[model samples]
Target: MKLSPSVSIEQSETGLEFINVASAKCDAKIFLQGGQITEFIPKNNKPLIWVSKNETFQEGVSIRGGIPICWPWFGNHQNPNWPAHGFARTSLWQADEVHENDEQITISLKLPMKQVNTTYWPHQSALKVEFILTDTLQVRLTTTNLSNAAFSYTQALHTYFPTSDIKNTTVDGLQGAQYIEFGEGPFTQSEHVSFERETDMVYTQAAVQQHIHTPDGIINVSRENSSSCVLWNPWIEKSKRLSNFADDEYLGMVCLEAANVLEDKVTLEPKQSHTLITTISWA
Candidate 1:
């Protein structure tokens, strides 16, 4: 990939390669290992993405924050031994293009199918992720079916956002959506969601836009081609068992993922394509 005035490729101390963007509008980093972005801070504003202080930047290991790409399958497969959240987050990606304009810098990356193990994902398809960085951030994940047969898959843009205090944070706009918590109750949401304990809610029929009210400010989150999303916080005990995360780190972060799980999974015919998008900005 050619270097631009606002973008350049850099390697971490652990040998992982990533693209760094430092333009007038923002500063960000996108790792090529998982096609994952671990940082995004708009100029003159607080960070819009949160990464764990103890995250491991090793080969084949997913970094613990930012936007992790969960693909092909989510959470777990029919077989219990399969890797949770699929293998996309640990797969190496090829940087396809980088462009810069007056308003933003865009980076495009694609998964190298040959590097992928067939045992995990045996389909012939193309996966690409694009990052649009300005004062706001936008991510687009596009999957294209290249084989003659049709296939179905589940995925999510697992985004982690920061908060001064989790207890004071609330997520609005899920008032009428249906959600399942800890494999229980496909119940309806009646008010703004807040965090008081470990939360893992999978929602369906969610509104296209949601607002996260943190001690810092209100962050607007919007999604496209997605009706399912996830809200999670490890709270205390669960946070202790999580790798690459501090025991009390849960107090400073929360995840509002744009996902396609359960009934929202996608099925594509040969030559068809689907794009799942999410945009973040200040409300």
Candidate 2:
């Protein structure tokens, strides 16, 4: 694959090597230590895959369609159609900038103004995603509407986390939260968060961050300007159809989506921008 113009590489204090794909609009981790992926991110756009592997240092949390960023709409959490989880995750992005130092590297990608979005989303806007990494990881998404008419949309950062066993894992920070059980599609559940057969609940008005505790370590998810969280694990059946997911892979990962949904649709006036920042730090 061709590297973007703004790409750069550097060494970190921990002896970790960083590879920033500024042009391809993504990040790559070519080196790590102790057989662990020191950094977690995506690679080139063809497969639109995220994560990297250096021998046993695999950072990939395989969930098939990569980390789908549902935008404009986060599927019909109330209905059944709307294409699983919306479409922003599949769209190709253009690199805008890249910067690197001994400790970290940052890469920015944008969805430029185009004639295509007029059909469904009739607003002129740009979606920008920034990848900021040290030995740790953070991703920030900014949406700017340049059209005269104001527009509203729901957004999500669907993260697939790696684990030894989902049964052994638990997500903290969602205690005593209420959610909508998506079967009749939007049925509300005002109960404590716990394990179920096929967990598909949308936790509304969540705390700005949460933690996914695995046997290995804790993956902390912190957000800014977001109000909703979705904790998902497709279990056995759903993992079969997805090519990028190994059989029964659902046992090893859970999706903790930092989202804006339902009554919380974000609106951007002309020349205005809305930003969603997510930081994934491990310990």
Q: What lDDT is obtained when candidate 1 is compared to the true structure?
A: 0.94
Tell me the tens digit of each residue's lDDT in model 2 across 1-283: 2343555555555444444343333345422111112235433212112231211222322124234566667766444643455545544445566666655667666655472345556777887777675545576778898888888888887766777777888877876555776644444444334454578778776778787777767777888888777888877777666655566667766778778876666978889998887777665
**lDDT of candidates 1 onward, in order:** 0.94, 0.61
Clashing pairs in 2: 4-23, 41-51, 42-50
What lDDT does model 2 reach?
0.61
After superposition, which runs of candidate 1 have C-alpha atoms over 4 Å from their true positions? none
Question: Candidates' TM-scores?
Answer: 0.99, 0.74
Candidate 2 segments exceeding 4 Å error: 1-66, 76-83, 183-196
Model 1 over residues 102-198: C-alpha lDDT tens digits? Answer: 9889899999999888998888999999999999999999999999999999999999999999999999999999999998989999999999899
lDDT of 2 at 113: 48
What are the per-model C-alpha RMSD values against the true structure? 0.7, 8.4
